[model samples]
Target: MKGRIVGVVLAAGASRRFGARDKLAARISGRAMVQAPARALSGLGLSRRAAITRTPRQPHALRGTGTALWSVGHRRPQAASLRRAVRGARATGASHLLIVLGDMPGIGRAELRALLRHGGLHPAMATDGRSLAPPALIPRRIFGPLLRLRGDRGAGALLRRRPDLRRVPLGAGALRDVDRPEDLRPPRTG
Candidate 1:
Protein backbone atom coordinates (compact mmCIF):
# COMPACT_ATOMS: atom_id res chain seq x y z
CA MET A 1 0.00 0.00 0.00
CA LYS A 2 1.10 3.58 -0.57
CA GLY A 3 1.88 5.89 2.37
CA ARG A 4 0.24 9.17 3.20
CA ILE A 5 2.34 12.25 3.82
CA VAL A 6 1.19 14.79 6.44
CA GLY A 7 2.50 18.32 6.75
CA VAL A 8 3.13 19.49 10.35
CA VAL A 9 4.18 23.05 11.07
CA LEU A 10 5.65 23.76 14.53
CA ALA A 11 4.81 27.34 15.59
CA ALA A 12 4.38 27.47 19.37
CA GLY A 13 7.54 29.14 20.57
CA ALA A 14 7.41 32.03 23.10
CA SER A 15 9.56 34.25 20.88
CA ARG A 16 11.53 35.58 23.82
CA ARG A 17 14.19 36.85 21.46
CA PHE A 18 11.74 38.91 19.39
CA GLY A 19 11.02 41.17 22.37
CA ALA A 20 7.27 41.96 22.67
CA ARG A 21 5.96 40.18 19.59
CA ASP A 22 5.58 36.63 18.33
CA LYS A 23 8.22 36.07 15.67
CA LEU A 24 6.04 33.63 13.83
CA ALA A 25 3.49 36.37 13.29
CA ALA A 26 6.12 38.94 12.43
CA ARG A 27 6.05 40.11 8.85
CA ILE A 28 8.92 39.59 6.46
CA SER A 29 8.42 41.12 3.01
CA GLY A 30 4.88 42.05 4.15
CA ARG A 31 3.87 38.47 4.93
CA ALA A 32 3.78 36.72 8.29
CA MET A 33 6.83 34.51 8.81
CA VAL A 34 4.67 31.48 9.57
CA GLN A 35 2.77 31.93 6.35
CA ALA A 36 5.88 31.33 4.25
CA PRO A 37 6.22 27.75 5.36
CA ALA A 38 2.46 27.24 5.67
CA ARG A 39 2.03 28.25 2.06
CA ALA A 40 4.74 25.83 1.05
CA LEU A 41 3.01 22.98 2.86
CA SER A 42 -0.31 23.87 1.28
CA GLY A 43 1.32 23.72 -2.13
CA LEU A 44 2.60 20.19 -1.48
CA GLY A 45 -0.85 18.64 -1.88
CA LEU A 46 -0.43 16.50 1.21
CA SER A 47 -3.22 14.32 2.54
CA ARG A 48 -3.51 16.62 5.58
CA ARG A 49 -1.89 19.82 6.83
CA ALA A 50 -1.66 20.79 10.52
CA ALA A 51 0.01 23.65 12.35
CA ILE A 52 0.80 23.00 16.03
CA THR A 53 1.13 25.67 18.66
CA ARG A 54 0.58 26.18 22.42
CA THR A 55 -0.99 29.61 22.23
CA PRO A 56 -4.32 29.94 24.09
CA ARG A 57 -6.06 30.47 20.79
CA GLN A 58 -5.07 30.37 17.15
CA PRO A 59 -3.32 33.70 16.64
CA HIS A 60 -5.16 36.28 14.53
CA ALA A 61 -1.83 36.08 12.76
CA LEU A 62 -2.78 32.73 11.28
CA ARG A 63 -6.18 33.79 10.01
CA GLY A 64 -6.84 32.75 6.37
CA THR A 65 -3.74 30.49 6.40
CA GLY A 66 -5.97 27.48 5.50
CA THR A 67 -3.94 25.08 7.64
CA ALA A 68 -5.98 23.15 10.22
CA LEU A 69 -5.71 23.59 13.99
CA TRP A 70 -3.41 21.20 15.81
CA SER A 71 -2.81 23.13 18.98
CA VAL A 72 -1.44 21.89 22.31
CA GLY A 73 -2.36 22.97 25.85
CA HIS A 74 -1.46 26.44 27.11
CA ARG A 75 1.93 26.80 28.87
CA ARG A 76 2.95 23.49 27.40
CA PRO A 77 6.42 22.99 25.99
CA GLN A 78 7.44 22.57 22.36
CA ALA A 79 7.57 18.84 22.88
CA ALA A 80 3.91 18.85 23.78
CA SER A 81 3.08 20.58 20.54
CA LEU A 82 5.22 18.09 18.62
CA ARG A 83 3.58 15.15 20.35
CA ARG A 84 0.14 16.47 19.54
CA ALA A 85 1.10 16.86 15.89
CA VAL A 86 2.61 13.40 15.75
CA ARG A 87 -0.41 11.74 17.36
CA GLY A 88 -2.77 13.59 15.07
CA ALA A 89 -0.73 12.55 12.05
CA ARG A 90 -0.87 8.94 13.19
CA ALA A 91 -4.61 9.15 13.70
CA THR A 92 -5.03 10.25 10.13
CA GLY A 93 -3.11 7.14 9.01
CA ALA A 94 -0.16 9.15 7.83
CA SER A 95 2.92 7.07 7.16
CA HIS A 96 5.30 10.01 7.11
CA LEU A 97 5.38 13.50 8.61
CA LEU A 98 7.03 16.56 7.10
CA ILE A 99 8.00 18.87 9.99
CA VAL A 100 8.87 22.49 9.34
CA LEU A 101 9.43 25.40 11.70
CA GLY A 102 6.90 28.22 11.54
CA ASP A 103 9.44 31.05 11.88
CA MET A 104 11.39 30.27 8.76
CA PRO A 105 10.88 33.06 6.22
CA GLY A 106 13.13 31.63 3.53
CA ILE A 107 11.21 28.38 3.26
CA GLY A 108 10.01 27.96 -0.30
CA ARG A 109 7.87 25.37 -2.03
CA ALA A 110 10.84 24.20 -4.07
CA GLU A 111 12.99 23.62 -1.00
CA LEU A 112 10.16 21.71 0.71
CA ARG A 113 9.74 19.57 -2.37
CA ALA A 114 13.48 18.85 -2.34
CA LEU A 115 13.34 17.60 1.25
CA LEU A 116 10.57 15.14 0.43
CA ARG A 117 12.39 13.92 -2.63
CA HIS A 118 15.52 13.01 -0.66
CA GLY A 119 13.81 11.78 2.48
CA GLY A 120 13.14 8.07 2.58
CA LEU A 121 11.54 5.92 5.30
CA HIS A 122 13.98 7.05 7.98
CA PRO A 123 14.29 10.59 9.35
CA ALA A 124 15.70 13.10 6.84
CA MET A 125 16.68 16.66 7.75
CA ALA A 126 18.00 19.76 6.00
CA THR A 127 21.47 20.90 6.93
CA ASP A 128 22.98 24.32 6.37
CA GLY A 129 26.59 23.09 6.51
CA ARG A 130 26.77 23.78 10.24
CA SER A 131 23.84 21.91 11.78
CA LEU A 132 20.87 19.76 10.90
CA ALA A 133 17.49 21.37 11.32
CA PRO A 134 13.96 21.37 10.16
CA PRO A 135 12.16 21.05 7.07
CA ALA A 136 12.64 17.45 8.23
CA LEU A 137 10.78 14.40 7.03
CA ILE A 138 10.20 11.63 9.58
CA PRO A 139 8.59 8.25 9.06
CA ARG A 140 6.10 6.59 11.39
CA ARG A 141 8.54 3.91 12.51
CA ILE A 142 10.46 6.68 14.28
CA PHE A 143 7.44 8.26 15.95
CA GLY A 144 7.96 6.23 19.15
CA PRO A 145 10.91 8.31 20.34
CA LEU A 146 9.16 11.54 19.43
CA LEU A 147 6.27 10.72 21.77
CA ARG A 148 8.73 10.15 24.63
CA LEU A 149 10.01 13.73 24.34
CA ARG A 150 9.37 16.40 26.96
CA GLY A 151 9.85 20.11 27.45
CA ASP A 152 10.56 22.62 24.66
CA ARG A 153 13.42 20.67 23.12
CA GLY A 154 12.48 19.67 19.61
CA ALA A 155 13.76 17.02 17.17
CA GLY A 156 17.37 17.80 18.03
CA ALA A 157 17.30 15.10 20.65
CA LEU A 158 16.17 12.49 18.15
CA LEU A 159 18.70 13.61 15.56
CA ARG A 160 21.51 13.50 18.09
CA ARG A 161 20.61 10.01 19.20
CA ARG A 162 20.05 8.68 15.74
CA PRO A 163 23.24 9.08 13.79
CA ASP A 164 21.52 7.25 11.00
CA LEU A 165 19.19 10.12 10.19
CA ARG A 166 19.66 11.21 6.58
CA ARG A 167 20.56 14.80 5.80
CA VAL A 168 19.90 16.87 2.69
CA PRO A 169 22.09 19.91 2.24
CA LEU A 170 20.37 23.25 1.78
CA GLY A 171 21.76 26.73 1.18
CA ALA A 172 22.22 29.13 4.10
CA GLY A 173 19.25 31.14 2.86
CA ALA A 174 16.83 28.26 3.05
CA LEU A 175 18.07 27.39 6.55
CA ARG A 176 17.83 30.90 8.00
CA ASP A 177 15.02 31.36 10.55
CA VAL A 178 13.60 34.46 12.22
CA ASP A 179 14.41 34.92 15.90
CA ARG A 180 14.94 38.65 16.36
CA PRO A 181 14.08 41.74 14.37
CA GLU A 182 17.33 41.62 12.44
CA ASP A 183 16.58 38.13 11.17
CA LEU A 184 13.63 39.49 9.25
CA ARG A 185 15.84 41.34 6.83
CA PRO A 186 15.50 40.40 3.18
CA PRO A 187 18.30 38.29 1.79
CA ARG A 188 21.14 40.22 0.22
CA THR A 189 20.93 40.49 -3.54
CA GLY A 190 24.10 41.55 -5.31
Candidate 2:
Protein backbone atom coordinates (compact mmCIF):
# COMPACT_ATOMS: atom_id res chain seq x y z
CA MET A 1 0.00 0.00 0.00
CA LYS A 2 2.98 2.25 0.45
CA GLY A 3 4.19 1.90 -3.13
CA ARG A 4 2.69 1.94 -6.56
CA ILE A 5 0.44 -1.04 -7.24
CA VAL A 6 -0.37 -1.90 -10.83
CA GLY A 7 -3.54 -3.81 -11.53
CA VAL A 8 -3.37 -6.50 -14.21
CA VAL A 9 -6.35 -8.32 -15.64
CA LEU A 10 -5.46 -11.67 -17.20
CA ALA A 11 -7.93 -12.09 -20.04
CA ALA A 12 -6.01 -14.05 -22.67
CA GLY A 13 -7.22 -17.55 -21.99
CA ALA A 14 -8.88 -19.44 -24.86
CA SER A 15 -12.47 -20.21 -23.89
CA ARG A 16 -12.10 -23.89 -24.73
CA ARG A 17 -14.67 -24.94 -22.15
CA PHE A 18 -17.09 -22.12 -22.87
CA GLY A 19 -17.89 -23.41 -26.36
CA ALA A 20 -17.01 -21.32 -29.43
CA ARG A 21 -17.71 -17.88 -28.04
CA ASP A 22 -15.21 -15.96 -25.91
CA LYS A 23 -16.20 -16.32 -22.28
CA LEU A 24 -14.87 -12.90 -21.37
CA ALA A 25 -17.15 -11.30 -23.94
CA ALA A 26 -20.20 -13.04 -22.57
CA ARG A 27 -22.51 -10.86 -20.52
CA ILE A 28 -23.03 -11.28 -16.81
CA SER A 29 -25.91 -9.22 -15.48
CA GLY A 30 -25.87 -6.43 -18.10
CA ARG A 31 -22.10 -6.16 -18.54
CA ALA A 32 -19.44 -8.21 -20.28
CA MET A 33 -17.82 -10.63 -17.85
CA VAL A 34 -14.35 -9.26 -18.53
CA GLN A 35 -15.49 -5.72 -17.82
CA ALA A 36 -16.47 -6.59 -14.29
CA PRO A 37 -12.92 -7.37 -13.25
CA ALA A 38 -11.38 -4.58 -15.28
CA ARG A 39 -13.82 -2.03 -13.91
CA ALA A 40 -13.08 -3.14 -10.39
CA LEU A 41 -9.34 -2.77 -10.88
CA SER A 42 -9.80 0.52 -12.68
CA GLY A 43 -11.94 1.86 -9.85
CA LEU A 44 -9.04 1.37 -7.46
CA GLY A 45 -7.09 4.13 -9.19
CA LEU A 46 -3.81 2.29 -9.00
CA SER A 47 -0.58 3.64 -10.47
CA ARG A 48 -1.52 1.85 -13.70
CA ARG A 49 -3.96 -0.76 -14.97
CA ALA A 50 -3.81 -3.14 -17.94
CA ALA A 51 -5.72 -6.05 -19.42
CA ILE A 52 -3.97 -8.84 -21.33
CA THR A 53 -5.84 -10.29 -24.25
CA ARG A 54 -5.15 -12.73 -27.06
CA THR A 55 -6.08 -10.23 -29.77
CA PRO A 56 -4.91 -6.74 -30.55
CA ARG A 57 -8.43 -5.41 -30.86
CA GLN A 58 -9.67 -3.95 -27.59
CA PRO A 59 -12.88 -5.13 -25.98
CA HIS A 60 -15.83 -2.73 -26.15
CA ALA A 61 -16.32 -2.96 -22.40
CA LEU A 62 -12.82 -1.65 -21.71
CA ARG A 63 -13.35 1.54 -23.70
CA GLY A 64 -13.21 4.74 -21.60
CA THR A 65 -12.21 2.78 -18.50
CA GLY A 66 -8.61 4.02 -18.89
CA THR A 67 -7.31 0.47 -18.72
CA ALA A 68 -4.67 -0.19 -21.34
CA LEU A 69 -4.97 -3.30 -23.47
CA TRP A 70 -1.92 -5.51 -24.08
CA SER A 71 -2.11 -8.33 -26.56
CA VAL A 72 -0.22 -11.60 -26.46
CA GLY A 73 -0.08 -14.47 -28.95
CA HIS A 74 -3.38 -16.26 -29.42
CA ARG A 75 -3.82 -19.42 -27.37
CA ARG A 76 -0.71 -18.68 -25.36
CA PRO A 77 -0.56 -20.15 -21.88
CA GLN A 78 -1.78 -18.19 -18.86
CA ALA A 79 1.80 -17.79 -17.66
CA ALA A 80 2.79 -16.11 -20.91
CA SER A 81 0.15 -13.44 -20.47
CA LEU A 82 0.95 -13.11 -16.76
CA ARG A 83 4.67 -12.76 -17.46
CA ARG A 84 3.92 -10.13 -20.04
CA ALA A 85 1.86 -8.19 -17.49
CA VAL A 86 4.57 -8.52 -14.84
CA ARG A 87 7.19 -7.10 -17.19
CA GLY A 88 4.94 -4.22 -18.14
CA ALA A 89 4.25 -3.43 -14.49
CA ARG A 90 7.95 -3.53 -13.69
CA ALA A 91 8.73 -1.18 -16.56
CA THR A 92 6.38 1.33 -14.98
CA GLY A 93 8.04 1.01 -11.54
CA ALA A 94 5.23 -0.90 -9.91
CA SER A 95 6.01 -2.09 -6.39
CA HIS A 96 3.14 -4.58 -6.31
CA LEU A 97 1.15 -6.43 -8.93
CA LEU A 98 -2.57 -6.89 -8.31
CA ILE A 99 -3.77 -9.77 -10.48
CA VAL A 100 -7.41 -10.48 -11.28
CA LEU A 101 -8.93 -13.07 -13.58
CA GLY A 102 -11.20 -11.71 -16.30
CA ASP A 103 -13.50 -14.70 -16.08
CA MET A 104 -14.17 -14.02 -12.40
CA PRO A 105 -17.05 -11.59 -12.64
CA GLY A 106 -17.96 -12.26 -9.04
CA ILE A 107 -14.84 -10.50 -7.75
CA GLY A 108 -15.39 -6.83 -7.10
CA ARG A 109 -13.90 -3.75 -5.47
CA ALA A 110 -14.53 -5.04 -1.95
CA GLU A 111 -12.45 -8.19 -2.31
CA LEU A 112 -9.71 -6.30 -4.13
CA ARG A 113 -9.54 -3.61 -1.47
CA ALA A 114 -9.29 -6.26 1.21
CA LEU A 115 -6.28 -7.78 -0.49
CA LEU A 116 -4.54 -4.43 -0.50
CA ARG A 117 -5.40 -3.65 3.11
CA HIS A 118 -4.04 -6.94 4.40
CA GLY A 119 -1.40 -7.43 1.74
CA GLY A 120 1.37 -5.69 3.79
CA LEU A 121 4.88 -6.01 2.29
CA HIS A 122 4.48 -9.63 1.29
CA PRO A 123 2.25 -11.35 -1.27
CA ALA A 124 -1.44 -11.68 -0.37
CA MET A 125 -3.99 -13.82 -2.20
CA ALA A 126 -7.70 -14.41 -1.81
CA THR A 127 -8.96 -17.61 -0.26
CA ASP A 128 -12.52 -18.92 0.02
CA GLY A 129 -11.62 -20.50 3.40
CA ARG A 130 -10.28 -23.35 1.27
CA SER A 131 -8.07 -23.09 -1.81
CA LEU A 132 -5.66 -20.22 -2.42
CA ALA A 133 -6.21 -18.31 -5.65
CA PRO A 134 -6.09 -15.03 -7.38
CA PRO A 135 -7.09 -11.71 -7.30
CA ALA A 136 -3.61 -11.87 -5.77
CA LEU A 137 -1.50 -8.93 -4.53
CA ILE A 138 2.14 -9.78 -5.19
CA PRO A 139 5.15 -7.65 -4.34
CA ARG A 140 7.66 -6.79 -7.06
CA ARG A 141 10.25 -8.95 -5.34
CA ILE A 142 8.23 -12.07 -6.20
CA PHE A 143 8.06 -11.23 -9.87
CA GLY A 144 11.04 -13.43 -10.64
CA PRO A 145 9.24 -16.67 -9.78
CA LEU A 146 6.18 -15.53 -11.69
CA LEU A 147 8.31 -14.88 -14.77
CA ARG A 148 9.58 -18.44 -14.56
CA LEU A 149 6.10 -19.99 -14.59
CA ARG A 150 5.50 -22.19 -17.65
CA GLY A 151 2.73 -23.30 -19.97
CA ASP A 152 -0.83 -22.96 -18.61
CA ARG A 153 0.41 -22.78 -15.02
CA GLY A 154 -0.65 -19.78 -12.98
CA ALA A 155 0.45 -18.13 -9.73
CA GLY A 156 -2.01 -20.10 -7.63
CA ALA A 157 0.27 -23.07 -7.12
CA LEU A 158 3.31 -20.94 -6.46
CA LEU A 159 1.47 -18.72 -3.99
CA ARG A 160 0.12 -21.75 -2.18
CA ARG A 161 3.64 -23.04 -1.71
CA ARG A 162 5.07 -19.79 -0.41
CA PRO A 163 5.38 -19.46 3.36
CA ASP A 164 5.27 -15.71 3.12
CA LEU A 165 1.99 -15.67 1.21
CA ARG A 166 -0.92 -14.17 3.14
CA ARG A 167 -4.37 -15.57 2.59
CA VAL A 168 -7.12 -12.98 2.63
CA PRO A 169 -10.48 -14.54 3.23
CA LEU A 170 -13.30 -13.54 0.92
CA GLY A 171 -16.95 -14.51 0.66
CA ALA A 172 -17.63 -18.05 -0.46
CA GLY A 173 -18.83 -17.11 -3.90
CA ALA A 174 -16.45 -14.22 -4.47
CA LEU A 175 -13.93 -16.33 -6.37
CA ARG A 176 -16.41 -18.18 -8.57
CA ASP A 177 -15.35 -18.08 -12.22
CA VAL A 178 -17.44 -18.76 -15.29
CA ASP A 179 -16.09 -21.74 -17.17
CA ARG A 180 -19.24 -22.85 -19.03
CA PRO A 181 -22.37 -21.13 -20.28
CA GLU A 182 -24.33 -22.71 -17.46
CA ASP A 183 -22.14 -20.93 -14.97
CA LEU A 184 -23.64 -17.62 -16.03
CA ARG A 185 -27.09 -18.48 -14.80
CA PRO A 186 -28.17 -16.82 -11.56
CA PRO A 187 -28.40 -19.01 -8.54
CA ARG A 188 -31.79 -20.64 -8.08
CA THR A 189 -33.81 -19.20 -5.25
CA GLY A 190 -36.02 -21.65 -3.47
Candidate 3:
Protein backbone atom coordinates (compact mmCIF):
# COMPACT_ATOMS: atom_id res chain seq x y z
CA MET A 1 0.00 0.00 0.00
CA LYS A 2 2.97 2.25 -0.48
CA GLY A 3 2.31 5.42 -2.42
CA ARG A 4 -1.33 4.55 -3.17
CA ILE A 5 -3.78 7.38 -3.72
CA VAL A 6 -5.59 9.16 -0.91
CA GLY A 7 -9.35 8.78 -0.63
CA VAL A 8 -11.26 11.94 0.36
CA VAL A 9 -14.75 11.91 1.86
CA LEU A 10 -16.62 15.22 1.49
CA ALA A 11 -18.65 15.34 4.70
CA ALA A 12 -18.62 19.09 5.21
CA GLY A 13 -22.09 19.96 3.99
CA ALA A 14 -24.55 22.12 5.92
CA SER A 15 -27.02 19.22 6.01
CA ARG A 16 -29.86 21.73 5.71
CA ARG A 17 -31.91 19.36 3.59
CA PHE A 18 -31.41 16.68 6.21
CA GLY A 19 -33.17 18.94 8.70
CA ALA A 20 -31.80 18.70 12.27
CA ARG A 21 -28.74 16.80 13.47
CA ASP A 22 -25.41 16.50 11.76
CA LYS A 23 -26.22 14.24 8.85
CA LEU A 24 -22.75 12.88 9.14
CA ALA A 25 -23.76 11.27 12.41
CA ALA A 26 -27.15 10.03 11.30
CA ARG A 27 -27.35 6.25 11.39
CA ILE A 28 -28.14 3.89 8.55
CA SER A 29 -29.06 0.43 9.76
CA GLY A 30 -26.07 0.07 12.15
CA ARG A 31 -23.77 2.82 10.90
CA ALA A 32 -23.76 6.60 10.85
CA MET A 33 -24.39 8.13 7.42
CA VAL A 34 -20.84 9.42 7.23
CA GLN A 35 -19.46 6.17 8.54
CA ALA A 36 -20.56 4.45 5.35
CA PRO A 37 -18.03 6.27 3.21
CA ALA A 38 -15.29 6.06 5.82
CA ARG A 39 -15.80 2.32 6.08
CA ALA A 40 -15.42 1.96 2.34
CA LEU A 41 -12.36 4.18 2.12
CA SER A 42 -10.57 2.80 5.18
CA GLY A 43 -9.98 -0.56 3.55
CA LEU A 44 -8.16 0.91 0.56
CA GLY A 45 -4.77 0.96 2.44
CA LEU A 46 -3.69 4.07 0.62
CA SER A 47 -1.76 5.37 3.70
CA ARG A 48 -4.00 8.44 3.87
CA ARG A 49 -7.68 9.02 4.47
CA ALA A 50 -9.34 12.33 5.36
CA ALA A 51 -12.86 13.52 6.01
CA ILE A 52 -13.68 17.18 5.46
CA THR A 53 -16.24 18.14 8.05
CA ARG A 54 -17.54 21.52 9.17
CA THR A 55 -14.97 21.08 11.90
CA PRO A 56 -12.01 18.74 12.19
CA ARG A 57 -14.39 16.25 13.74
CA GLN A 58 -13.56 12.79 12.43
CA PRO A 59 -15.42 9.70 13.50
CA HIS A 60 -13.66 8.76 16.72
CA ALA A 61 -15.09 5.26 16.45
CA LEU A 62 -13.08 4.97 13.24
CA ARG A 63 -9.84 6.02 14.88
CA GLY A 64 -7.19 3.70 16.42
CA THR A 65 -5.85 1.91 13.37
CA GLY A 66 -2.95 3.87 11.92
CA THR A 67 -4.28 2.97 8.52
CA ALA A 68 -7.21 5.29 9.06
CA LEU A 69 -6.65 8.97 8.18
CA TRP A 70 -6.98 12.52 9.38
CA SER A 71 -10.06 14.68 9.68
CA VAL A 72 -9.79 18.29 8.50
CA GLY A 73 -11.97 21.13 9.78
CA HIS A 74 -13.42 23.89 7.67
CA ARG A 75 -15.53 26.83 8.81
CA ARG A 76 -17.15 27.71 5.48
CA PRO A 77 -18.38 26.51 2.09
CA GLN A 78 -18.15 23.12 0.32
CA ALA A 79 -15.50 24.48 -2.01
CA ALA A 80 -13.27 25.06 0.99
CA SER A 81 -13.75 21.43 1.89
CA LEU A 82 -12.35 20.16 -1.41
CA ARG A 83 -9.53 22.66 -1.39
CA ARG A 84 -8.57 21.72 2.16
CA ALA A 85 -8.97 18.03 1.38
CA VAL A 86 -6.63 18.11 -1.61
CA ARG A 87 -4.11 20.29 0.15
CA GLY A 88 -4.02 18.16 3.29
CA ALA A 89 -3.78 14.90 1.37
CA ARG A 90 -1.06 16.34 -0.82
CA ALA A 91 0.97 17.17 2.28
CA THR A 92 0.99 13.46 3.07
CA GLY A 93 2.21 12.32 -0.37
CA ALA A 94 -1.07 11.53 -2.10
CA SER A 95 -0.41 11.03 -5.82
CA HIS A 96 -4.09 11.11 -6.71
CA LEU A 97 -7.30 11.66 -4.81
CA LEU A 98 -10.52 9.65 -5.08
CA ILE A 99 -13.42 11.76 -3.80
CA VAL A 100 -16.48 9.99 -2.45
CA LEU A 101 -19.58 11.48 -0.90
CA GLY A 102 -20.54 11.03 2.76
CA ASP A 103 -24.08 10.04 1.84
CA MET A 104 -23.78 7.24 -0.74
CA PRO A 105 -24.18 4.13 1.37
CA GLY A 106 -24.55 1.79 -1.59
CA ILE A 107 -21.08 2.43 -3.00
CA GLY A 108 -19.06 -0.68 -2.15
CA ARG A 109 -15.38 -1.37 -1.62
CA ALA A 110 -15.01 -3.23 -4.90
CA GLU A 111 -16.45 -0.31 -6.79
CA LEU A 112 -14.08 2.07 -5.04
CA ARG A 113 -11.10 -0.10 -6.01
CA ALA A 114 -12.36 -0.10 -9.56
CA LEU A 115 -12.81 3.65 -9.45
CA LEU A 116 -9.29 4.14 -8.21
CA ARG A 117 -7.84 1.83 -10.83
CA HIS A 118 -9.77 3.51 -13.61
CA GLY A 119 -8.90 6.90 -12.13
CA GLY A 120 -5.21 6.22 -12.61
CA LEU A 121 -5.67 6.72 -16.35
CA HIS A 122 -8.39 9.35 -16.33
CA PRO A 123 -9.71 12.13 -14.14
CA ALA A 124 -13.29 10.91 -13.83
CA MET A 125 -16.60 11.80 -12.17
CA ALA A 126 -19.14 9.34 -10.82
CA THR A 127 -22.67 9.83 -12.04
CA ASP A 128 -25.64 8.10 -13.63
CA GLY A 129 -26.59 11.46 -15.20
CA ARG A 130 -29.68 12.03 -13.06
CA SER A 131 -29.29 13.56 -9.59
CA LEU A 132 -26.46 12.50 -7.29
CA ALA A 133 -22.94 13.56 -8.22
CA PRO A 134 -19.58 15.15 -7.06
CA PRO A 135 -17.65 11.93 -6.40
CA ALA A 136 -14.61 11.54 -8.67
CA LEU A 137 -11.00 10.57 -9.21
CA ILE A 138 -8.72 13.59 -9.40
CA PRO A 139 -5.09 13.90 -10.28
CA ARG A 140 -2.82 16.25 -8.37
CA ARG A 141 -2.47 18.19 -11.60
CA ILE A 142 -6.14 19.11 -11.37
CA PHE A 143 -5.86 20.64 -7.91
CA GLY A 144 -6.63 24.03 -9.41
CA PRO A 145 -10.10 22.89 -10.43
CA LEU A 146 -10.81 21.46 -7.02
CA LEU A 147 -9.74 24.70 -5.41
CA ARG A 148 -11.83 26.68 -7.86
CA LEU A 149 -15.03 24.72 -7.20
CA ARG A 150 -17.61 26.76 -5.31
CA GLY A 151 -21.32 26.78 -4.30
CA ASP A 152 -23.60 24.07 -2.91
CA ARG A 153 -23.30 21.55 -5.78
CA GLY A 154 -19.54 21.08 -5.26
CA ALA A 155 -17.10 20.12 -8.00
CA GLY A 156 -19.33 19.02 -10.89
CA ALA A 157 -18.69 22.12 -12.96
CA LEU A 158 -14.96 21.87 -12.41
CA LEU A 159 -14.96 18.52 -14.19
CA ARG A 160 -17.11 19.81 -17.03
CA ARG A 161 -14.83 22.77 -17.68
CA ARG A 162 -11.92 20.42 -18.14
CA PRO A 163 -12.44 18.93 -21.58
CA ASP A 164 -9.25 16.92 -21.28
CA LEU A 165 -10.65 14.76 -18.49
CA ARG A 166 -12.23 11.32 -18.86
CA ARG A 167 -15.23 10.17 -16.87
CA VAL A 168 -16.23 6.76 -15.54
CA PRO A 169 -19.84 5.84 -14.82
CA LEU A 170 -20.21 3.85 -11.58
CA GLY A 171 -23.97 3.64 -11.94
CA ALA A 172 -26.55 4.62 -9.30
CA GLY A 173 -24.32 4.30 -6.27
CA ALA A 174 -22.00 6.89 -7.71
CA LEU A 175 -24.90 9.24 -8.18
CA ARG A 176 -26.86 8.23 -5.06
CA ASP A 177 -26.43 10.67 -2.18
CA VAL A 178 -28.54 10.85 0.97
CA ASP A 179 -30.14 14.26 1.35
CA ARG A 180 -33.28 13.37 3.25
CA PRO A 181 -34.57 10.89 5.82
CA GLU A 182 -36.03 8.74 3.06
CA ASP A 183 -32.57 8.45 1.54
CA LEU A 184 -31.32 6.31 4.43
CA ARG A 185 -33.97 3.66 3.99
CA PRO A 186 -33.20 0.74 1.72
CA PRO A 187 -34.89 0.62 -1.65
CA ARG A 188 -37.82 -1.77 -1.95
CA THR A 189 -36.62 -4.97 -3.65
CA GLY A 190 -39.91 -5.51 -5.46
lDDT digits (tens) for residues 37-152 of candidate 2: 88888667699999998888887867766789888878798889989999999999999999999999888999999999987678999988978878999999999999999998
Worst 10 residues of 3 by lDDT: 61-70
Error of 1 at 30 (Å): 1.1
Is 1 or 2 the stronger prediction by lDDT? 2
Index of the highest-lDDT prediction: 2
Q: Assess the local accuracy of residue 188 in candidate 1 as a C-alpha lDDT between 0 and 100.
A: 83
Overall lDDT per candidate, in order of appearance: 0.83, 0.88, 0.68
TM-score of each: 0.92, 0.95, 0.83
| Candidate 2: regions farther than 4 A off | none
Q: What C-alpha lDDT, on a 0 to 100 scale, does residue 87 get in candidate 1? A: 97
Estimate candidate 1's alpha-carbon lDDT, on a 0 to 1 scale. Answer: 0.83
The total of clashing pairs for model 1 equals: 0
Model 1 TM-score? 0.92
**Any idea what lDDT model 2 has?**
0.88
lDDT of 3 by residue, 69-185 (tens): 444454467777778788876787777888888777777677677667666645776656554255677777787667766654466667777775665567774456788877877
